[model samples]
Each structure stands twice: as C-alpha cells, then as structure tokens.
Target: MRNLTTSTFSLSAFLQRTQGKKVVLIYPWSNLKTQFLSSYLDQAKDGILYYRVPGETVNLVDWIDGMLNEFRTVLGDKFGKKTSAALAERIPAHIGEALASDLGAVVKSETILYLDDLDQINFDDEFNHWAQAFVSALPEKLQLVISARMLSRHPWDHMVASGDAVVIGVETRKSAMAFTVDTDDRPQLECYAFGRGNILLNGKPVTTWEGTLPRTLAFFLIDHPLVTRDEIFHAFWPDLSVKDATNVFHVTKRKVNERVTSRIDDDKQYELTQYTSGFYVASEKLVRHYDVQEFQEAVQQALVASDDRREQLLYQRAIDLYRAPFLQTVNQPWANDRRDELRRLYAVALTGMGRIFLRKGEMNRALGFLSRAAREAPEREDVHRDVIRLYLEFGMIHEARQQYDVMEQALSSSMNLQPTKDSRALLESIKARS
Candidate 1:
C-alpha cells in the first residue's frame, strides 16, 4: 500500500522539516526529541548553541546573564576590545531583542538557541512569561529550539497557529520513509496512537490506511473495547440518517479490515473487528495491541500495585508509554474527546511518578514529576498542592507562593473556579510554619 523506503530521523531530515519555523516546540511526550537533536547537533556543528538545563532550579535572568557572558567569550573577536569583556549589574528589560540584534549583526548565519531538558527549570508563571516573550522578541536570524519537555504553561499555540512555530513529529498519515522489522512472531496489530498514529501489523509497519476514514475508524475501534453500532454511527456519520449512516459505516468498516488484511501476505482468515450482541469489538481471532490501552492499564495496575517498587515501576511504564497525546492528527469530536481522556490519564501517571519518588525521599525527582503533572492537569488541585508543599520543603518560600498563584490563575482561567478551601489552608499553614 506504500513505498518501501527507509527514512531515518536524521539531522538533514529534521532541518528540512523544520526549515522555515523560527520556534521549534518538540512535543513534550516524545522520547526522540533529545536523540534527534543530539545527532543533529553532532552533524551540524555550527550556528547552534546547545544549553542543557541543569537538573535543578533555573533562574531565567541568571541563565540569560550566564549565556551572554559565554557568548562574549565565544564571539568576542567580533566585538571591539572595549566591548569584549564587561559584566553588567542587571539584565536589560529587552534582553532578547537586544541580544538578537547584537548577535545578528556579527554572526554570518542564523543562530539557534536549543534549550534541552526544560523540565528541569522550575515552572513559575513569571519565568514562563519571560520565556514566551523572549521567543517572540527574537530576530529573524535568531531561533528558539526548545525540547519537547518544554512546559505547556507557556502558551505557544498562537505562535504555532501563525506559522512562526512548528511542532515536530505530529504527522503520520504518509509512509514514514522506512522499513519495519518483523521482530515479534505473534500476529497482532500494534496501534501506537501517541505522537502520531503508527500502526504495525505483525511487527511490520502499515503505512497507508486506504483512506482517512478507515484509519480513524480502526483507531476508534481499537481504543474502545466494545462500542455500540449506533455510537459508531454517531461518531463517524452523525449528520446522516440511520439507514444512510449504517450503509456508510459498513463500507468504512469493510475498508478498515481490507487495509489490514491486505498488509498481511498470509491467507489466514481473520476479521479485524467483530460484531456481537449489538456491540462491535476487536476480533478475538486478530490480536490487537494499542499503546493507549497498555498505558491506561499500567496506570490502573499502579493504583492497585501490591508494593511501592512495583507501583513505581508500573507508573513509570505508563508515563513512558504515553509518548504523545492520542491521535494527534485526528481532530474529530470523538478523537478530541478520547485525546482529552488519555491526557488526563497521562497526568495521573505523572502524579503517580511524583508520589512514588516522594516516598523514596527523592525530593528533586518528586518535584519535577509533580510540577509537570500540575501543568499537564491544571485542575488537579491535589497535584498543585504537592508542588506547593515540595517548594516549601526546598525552602523556596517565593516559589511556593508563585506556584499557588499559578494554580489560582489556571483554575480561574480554565473553569472560572477557585482552588479548594483546603488548598488555600495548606498553603497558608505551610507558609505560617516556614
């Protein structure tokens, strides 16, 4: 159904995909972000400044100050002797623009500021505001390439919509320019709905879906253990009458099975999806493995895990399995609704990670996981409380206050509601003790 081509996630490939975008926000869930960048940096060794955020709190102002000093040392020859070495008492208000201009004037080509492992940086609203502003203020020749782990608290949706930014690894409808190995012997369909929807039939990649509707339906069926025929009609052909919808649904459903059966060279009879008791489900004859299914199962297992270590392992597995949102490219109401549910599960997985690490007395790891979870699930007041308490534990009084404000703002903005009275009490009590 597709070309047998090998597409490596190489440096040149990345450059070509991200050519015109000034701001590159690698989606947070991807494990490939750092690996792709690392190889890219190794190959394209010029015009790129890679700054790996330390595994601790990062003051934006301090980081910028330090960066500017490093820049002077590297590009010092471009500046005159008098301007080559100077330490400032305070960072200028318009540091991004000024630095962009100064650097733009001297550099022969465009420069990329690659901020990797952004999860390490404490997610305060003030810092987030500055980061967004800094990105917007960059010159044409200046680029802000941040890791996928960049906090969602920074609103870059507008930038992405305007074509000023591009989120890498979001498309998967076409052939991925590669060959998949048949590693697993079992005849199962591997539906990876994270990052993009990648389907592997019997360990061999299934590139084409015949049509979009077929692919969408396959994923939907794979997602739900069982669905009523009427529900499928509503999700796919809501506007059509029952008679017309049923006709269309049968055609689409047939197409899905055909596409999968076509991919397999065997003559073994298999039905991709089955209908029984007025419910459509994945066929018992055909094994199906959806990443989202496993991801949710892992979280569920973690909840009832017998031991802390096993619980921690299960949570980590779920967190790792959630490489991205469910069906990123699919924008239908059903897909969107499923994506929201998966994201909430992911948020739960993150919270579980934080709690497990907290039990282990790994405060920094616990704090990072909790902060990420807080941002992921803005309305998760319990997670927000954990972050606030963690900040207090670290003696970050100001940070704790800022985190509370973030929760208040998020709750107000998203749902037009306030934090629970208990949340307020916890912060106040913690502060009083501190």
Candidate 2:
C-alpha cells in the first residue's frame, strides 16, 4: 500500500499543491461547486473554457477561439498567427505549434488553463482531436485543470500512463487499486453493514472473519453509533457477570481493531472502533463511506423534496443502495431487531417509488415495484391497493382479484380485520369489471 495522500479543503491549497502536475482532473464532490470555483478563478490569471451556449451547439473552432482569447487576455499575446491541424492521432510537439510556442517563450511564471464541465461538451471527434493537441503541447509555463463530474479515458489513457497527466479527484476501488498509484486522497475505508455485512480498508475488502464474536462486535459499533459500554455488555454477554463481560468485551474489541488495522497498509494506526464520552463509535479521523448512513440521508431528503422529479430521483437512489436485507447473515438478537427496523424502511421506500411511478403513468413498473413491496411487507394495505389498481388499470382482472385476496389474507393473519370501505369498493369493482 502506497502512502495515503492528504489534501486541504481550500482552492489555494489545492492549486499550490498540484501545480507541478500537467493535468488535474477534479470531481465536484462538495455542494459549494460552481460558486466556489468561479470565485477562486476570478482571482487568478488563467485560461478559461466553458461548455455552455444556450440554444446553440458549440464546435471545435468555437472552443479553441475561446481558449486562445483567454490565453491572450492572461498572457498578453504578441503574435496573431494561426495554424491548421488534421483530426488524425498525431499532432505537433509544441503547445498549439507556432501560436503557443510564441506564448510559451514569453511566459515567465506558471499559469493555469481551467476547463469547466468538459464532460458536458458536445460529442465531436474534431473537437477532441484539438483538445488532445492543446493538452499534449502545454509548455512548462501552463498547467491544464479539467473540472468535471466525469471524464472518459480517451487520448488521456496514454498521457496518464506516461505520467504527464495526473487525476486528483478519484477513489481507487475493487481489483483496480492494486496496480499502483503514486498518491491518492480517496476514502481509505468503507463499511456497508446493509445486506451481507462487509468491511473494506485501502480499497481492499477484509473478507475473512477469524471469529464470530469479533465480527459481531465490529457491526455493533457501526450499527449503533455511540453505543454504551453497558449495551455492548448486555448484547454480547448478558449471561456473564459485568466484571467478566467487561474483560471479554475489551479483549474482543482490541482483536477487531487489530484485524482491521492489519489489512490497511498505512504505517500510522487508525481506530476502527473509537471510544469517546462513555460511548463507542467509529473513528472520526478515518475517511470512510457508510451505505446505511447514505440510505437514511437520501430517504430523509426525498421525504421533504418539493419537486416531484427530485423526490423520485432521491427515492430511487435510496432504493438502489439496498442490495439485500440488512445483516442477512447475523442472527444475533440485537442484529435481528436492527435488521427488522431497516427492512421496514426498505419496504416503505419501495412503496414510495411504486406510487411515484404510478403518478407518471408507468403502470407496469408501478405494479412490479408495488408487488415487491407487498412481498416484503404484506401488512401494507395501501401498497396492496396500489398494486391492485395498477393491475386493474392494465386490464389484468384475474391478477387484481388475486392481489385483493392476498391483501385480505395478510390483514386477516396480521390484524384479524377486513379491508376498509374504500378498498372493498375497489375489490367489488374488480369483480364487476371481470
């Protein structure tokens, strides 16, 4: 494992730190995106490139014109010469050949060429050809900064391979992280406690659990943030006396931390399970991603979203994160209770998505999602009615009747009650339509 790189949250810090590299690919991960970038760039003498032109498409020449104009504005260009270049892979060695060679010779101090939203540019090979030429030919006086939410590996694959370009905003994950990167500031650890519980350190999963108790202890700290020492004792060692449990718990916690630390390549130690203020919590210093935290946050945002499209998107994001039942493998009593709670929320999310689709006139997708909700939580009468209505709207009379029967059975088994008057009316209509 290479040494983990650290970066400050300020634009000045980032520019000063990464100025040596030719191409810096930045991801818009934070909320203060456009405004933050614009404010900082206004203070610097740099070449600007924007990929927006309302009600019209921008071609290669337009982009080049904008960039050259920016360079002139910043560097005070003395030459007005232009040269023609083909769309072939090969381009001249110097920056824009004759035009940039003049600029490079005059530049005393280094400057920046900032490209905003290069991802949004129109798909044109000729534009890409010139873009590649500009990057490859950059003199030591100027560095290229491409700020994009996403960037495809095109001509860049070679530049990155040759160490001429560097990508700043990226997380190394999966088998790909193994090859070797000189520096990275991506999340060094992440735990997805939902579905089958798993832990990853330095982009590699710690797949083996040497003991059951250690694994369960790890989940306990993650599942219930700020867990009390007493609660941990009660959950894992209720039968054992307090004196005995405390000793055992401490030993187990240390083992879990050691196992977690061993997997990471960093020489500096990190506490996977941090104890603070009479409570046990995950480490605050360690950079990490928790899927459970993301799922809950998305659901909370979707519930309050004012726009329908935004609401639908947030709910979809939350639903997609739930790959399976929470903690499916662990059968501990405490795990079971938390699992049940998360499962209920999952059903609610599914029902919410089903109704959202129904509102958009997508009856088939609505029915499919509503049916899954019914399976996970049969007691939801509203979900059943929504599914039955979609089936009836699609002229599936028999299926509607079958769904009504399932709803009736669920209510009978769970609550010993009949469907409401409004639902019964829908049932009677299903029979009449048949």
Candidate 3:
C-alpha cells in the first residue's frame, strides 16, 4: 500500500519494488493521474494484466468475471479458456474455490495483475473478505498492483499480517528526502545558483522561471536582497522609461508570485517584500539557502582567518561552492562585477594553496595548483610568475619559457602592458638555466 504523492511516484522506484510480491498503488482519480499510471505501466518491462474497474454496479460474481475477461484477453491460452469458462459458470458459493484453483494455473513468471482505481468498485464487507482470500490464494509468482484513492474497509490488515503487503506513506517518501526538495509546507525556498541559476522549491525546479526575464529577475532578487524599483528597471529593462518599466515590473512580479504560490503550500507565501525605501527583496519570512550566499560567506571567512591552515581550509570551502562564474548564463552588466570578484577570489585561493604547498617543498602539487590559478586568471602576472619559477626549479626550462610567453601575450593583448621587471628577470634566469 503506497500512499502516493506528486514526488514519490516515479517509474524507477515503482519498478524496483515489484520484485516478487503483490503491490498496491493507491491514488485519487484524475485524467492526468490516469494517464501517468497507464503510461508507466505500459512501459514496464514485465507483462501486466491492466484492468480499470467498470462504473456500473455489479455483483461480486460479475466483478470477478469482468476481471477474468481482462486477464483472458492478455494471457489468452495461458489463462486456460476451459478453466475460465468453468469458473464463470460456478455459483456464488463455489466461486472462491474455482478462482483459487484457476489463479494458480494463470500466474507465471513476470506476470502482474494491475488493478487501477480499486476504490471505484464499491466493496461491501463480504466482497472485501473474498478479495482478501482470493488474493492470498494466488501464486507467489503473480504480483498484484492496485491503485485507488482509498481502500476504506478493505481487508488489508489481514493481508499485511500474513507478510503479503507493505504500506508506504508520506513519511516513507520523506525518508527518501535526499533525492527531493520539500517545497510544500516548508518555510524557505532553497535556491541553487552555482553552475546555472536554478530556483528550486520542494526539490523541484519552479516553472515560473522558465522564461528568461522571470528567471533573470529571480537571480537578481536573490543576488540583490534589497533592490529598488529603479535598480530593477535599470538592470533588466534599461531601454524603457521609468513608467514603462514600472508596468513590466508589476506584470512580471505577479507572474513570479503566482508561480511561487502554486509551488509552495506554506501559509506565509514566498514573496518579494517592499521596504519603506521602495526597495524589494525576497520576503524576510522566506529564508533562502543560496549557494552564492554560502560562497561569499566562505570567502569572507577566509579573509578573516587568523591562521594559514584555517585560511586554506576556508578558501577551499569557498572554491568548492563556486562551481562556476555566478549566474554564468545571465549576461547582464550587473553580473560582471560579481563575476570578476569571484574569479579573483578563486584565483587568489588557488595561488594561496599553491604557495602553501611550495613552502612545504611539495613541488608537483604546488605546480598543479599554480597551473589552475593561472588558468583562472591568465593575465595575473603573479600567478604566471610563480608557475614559471616552479617550472625552472623543477628543471622544466621549456615549460617555464612557455609560461612566460603566455603571460607576456596576455598582458600585451588585454592591457597593452609588458611583463614587469621581475617577470623579465625570471625569464632571463630560466633562459640561463636552459
């Protein structure tokens, strides 16, 4: 018995559990729900006897006949036509015995009797007891998967007691929380902005931000906690006049609010609160667990560290959080400043790590890190100089000369500047060593 939720029911997890037992998948009826379940079962590897309970009222005997008709259609000769005919002809009293005998012959390897919307069939106490007995009598190889809104008074307790059933509730889905983000009923929305900007709520991506403007707006809000109307206008709609921008702002904001509200079920909605100074920020009540926030905090920690070991650890922590340039896809002028700032931090962190390793005479490791630092900031003469010095020390004179050439070209092309006197002197020294 799986108490299905929007997040918990995926094809892979469902397939994994139907190994060698009867299964029940209960859910409310909707066109979407029906399509989802049917599509999933259709794609399932094993052959399944899929039956949707009929709407008209029928006796238990007729219900059983209808179910067998579906099975006969799917299994054909394997269901044994003679036996099926015999069972259908039986009186209500002897129907259970006939079914128990016939079911054993019908069940085989990789066969599933999938009953959709079991709750649709109005089950009285006698019908419920009969269902329990009939299911128990089926071969172990035959798997039963049931879907319904509620079982109501089904004899599930007895079935479960005999180790023929298991119940999966919302809490069971919660146990697999590591794979999902809780957006429903949670106080805060977790926004991940490392590689690309993904505004996640309840472990799912929000549909509101699928549009470029809306997504960019979300990133802007998360990045700039308190943004005035003018700031938003300038950042996103620079070409528009203040009045026109204001119109766009309200429309977009409403769309964003609707998206957030639809996704999150919290009483206190995820919102952008307006300050007295006419600045807007994500609601104070809605806590944001942003990757950029963590990255910045790590860098700040590294800056204030009292010890070299502590500084190294903090810098590495910052680097790990910075998967790439902040909002790499959002090519906005406002993003450029922060992007450069983070790039600098990354380069500095790598250089500091390299220098620490170099001082300890770990030549190869030091060079590896310095090489990364140089890649992060190709025009940073200091990082390149260190790499050149390490290459010379390691007797890789050609590599040292190559490093010097790269620095010289980058400086000349980007800044129209030459390498410093120290850099020139280092190249001369590498030349003499060669």
Candidate 4:
C-alpha cells in the first residue's frame, strides 16, 4: 500500500509549482475535493476562483455575458475592464472560444486558471474544437487545472498527451474501527475490530455472515442518522400497508437480535440500537468517504451564500455537483421527496443561470439553459415562460410557437386553466413576427 501522507505531501509540492505557471492538472472524476486545490493554492499565495459555463440546455452567449458582468463586479474596475472586453469579444461565438481568448490572457500573465468540473461540458466536435483552441491559446505562465469525474475519450487524451498535465486518482479505504463477529465458540460473540477486514466473534471469524446487507444497512443508517424506522420499512417494502409494515419491523428486529444477541457478551450491548422511531448504527468512530458528498456539500454551500453572491456560486455548484440525480438507483419512497427537491433545485439553479446568460446577450446559451429548465420542470410556468421568451428573442419563431403550445397544454392539464395573458400576448407577438 502507498503511504497516503507521503503521496499527499508530494502532490501538494507538485501543485505549488504550478502556481503562477501555465500547467493543466487533469484530476479524475473520483477526486471531488475543492478544499484540496484551495488549500494548495492558499499555501502558494494564489487565489481560488470559479466559472459558470452555460449547460447544454442553456444559451451560451447569455451565460458568458453574465459571467463577465460577475467578474467585473467581483474584481473591481481595472481587472473587470480587461476581463469584460475579452469576454464580450469571445462570448458571442461559444464558451470554448470565449474561455480560450479570455482565460488565455490570464494564463499568459502567469495567473492560475482552475477549470473545476470540466467534465460537465459535453464532448462534441464543436466542444472539442473549442477545447483545443483554448488549450492551444494557453501561455507558458498560465496554470490550467481541469477537474472532472472521468476522462473524456476524445480530445482529452490528446490534450493530456501533448499538454503538461498530471493525473491524480483518489481511492477510499476501510474505516479504522469496524465491527467483528466471531462464530468459533459454541455461542458466537461480537467484538470491535480496529482496522481489520473481518469481524471476530468470541475470538473467531464469523463465517455465517457472508453478504454485505448488514454493512450496507449500517452505512445507510450512519449516513442518515435522522432516518426513521418507517422510512426504512418503506424503503425495504414499498408496497406494504402500514399494518403489514409492522411485520417488517418484527422481522428486522429478529435479524438484528440473531446477529447482535448471539455475538454480544452478557455485559455488552448490541451495536445497532433503536431510539424513539429510528434505528441507530453505533459506529460513530467509523468515517466513510464519498465523492458525491463532497460535491453536494460544495454546491449546497455555494447556494446558501448571500443573494448578491448566489448566482456565480450556484452556477459553479450546479456545474460541479450535478453529475446525475442524487442516488439515481435508490428507488425508495423516502428518497422520493429528496429527489424531487433536488430536481426542483437543479431546475431553479439552471434557470437562474439562464437568466444570467440572457442578461449578458448570450441568447444561444441562455436558450439552451432555459430550455433545459423548462424540460426538467415542465409543470413550472416560469421555466416555460423563460424558454418562450428566449426563443422569441432569438427569432426562433417555430420553436417559440412550440414552447407556447407546450405551455398551453401543461397549464390546461395541471391547472385546468388557459395560458396566462402575458404568455398569450407573447405568443401573439411571435405569430405577428412570423
């Protein structure tokens, strides 16, 4: 096994060297720690920065303009002037072009360009062209770091081969303190094993427990400390009625007893405990690491920041965190509420980003983002309205009409009412233009 401390120290040193120099760090998707880069940059007396590229569903032009405006606000008059001019020139073309021209200048001057979550950008011919141009435009003094979940198969490999790039992989290790069950004795006993793989019961390894059900359940409980027994039952038996669900609890308790009662010594208690309505997995010392948690926390923190700073933070957070719907495969009713919440939040975030793009006159990017928001939240009148407006603004008459029809259908189905007067007026205007 590699020495984690030594590896981290060496990586830190390598990162420090890239400060004030044109170096691209291509981080793997699995490594989702912004703090690592922030700490390294802080040590090297470099500032941490972020950017919000319009998503596939948003208008790129608008997103660029909004970002430039934000840059102006954050950096003050002098830096803002230079950045804004560059952004204005390149934004109309596409994010790649804009980033290349604008960020290229920063790199040329020996500034660090941290492209966090570069994996979110869809890889296509146009995107590839933009990436190539952007990388090609980088000056020797500029340090460009692109962090993503996974490596793209196309131009990314080519870029890494040609560019001065370093790849880093993050891996997880078992918790230092884990439970053990030993079934060697006539009555197996459970014990706490420190940094060992298997559980020991009565000084012997427990052979009966072969699967990971206990471990997985324990992990779930630990992560969701507030989770209730009702939620668990629902997750395990989604179709069961409330009365029938009591049977699930009884069955679960039996399983728990079978595992804990037999293993625990007469004087000791079971690791899993029931308090009030929920079960608690007693592994407080055990710490599990997940990349998704890091990503979610980063995005959530950014979103909760002040409204003045919300746009850029939310955009950056959405860009980095939204790999897919949270826990995509966990189809439990308990998760349904959270899933819906995240979906709504994501749609709002996208729409907020689209508004920024629209304000910046990047109509294409704005339309893309707004359109996606509309699709994600089809029932949301606001999202549909925004999409229709963007389509009309860009002289996409047919698209505008289509969006209006969608809105009409959605309003009729969901609310049992006609489209709002404002929406009707906008459609009328589009019709006149067509």
Best by TM-score: 2
lDDT of 3 by residue, 209-234 (tens): 54677777777777777668888898
Q: What is the lDDT for 49 in model 3?
A: 60
**lDDT of candidates 1 onward, in order:** 0.68, 0.65, 0.64, 0.53
Which is the leading candidate under lDDT?
1
Cα displacement (Å) at residue 421, model 3? 1.0
As a whole number from 0 to 100, the lDDT of residue 355 in candidate 1 is 91
Can you give the lDDT of residue 195 in candidate 4?
17
Worst 10 residues of 4 by lDDT: 176-185
lDDT for predicted candidate 1 compared with the true structure? 0.68
Q: Which pairs in model 2 have colliding backbones?
A: none
The worst-scoring run of ten residues by lDDT in candidate 3 lies at 170-179
lDDT of 2 by residue, 281-355 (tens): 657544555666556645655666556655665577567668787889999899888777777777877888888
By summed lDDT, the worst window of 10 consecutive residues in model 1 runs over 171-180
lDDT of 4: 0.53
The local distance difference test score of model 2 is: 0.65
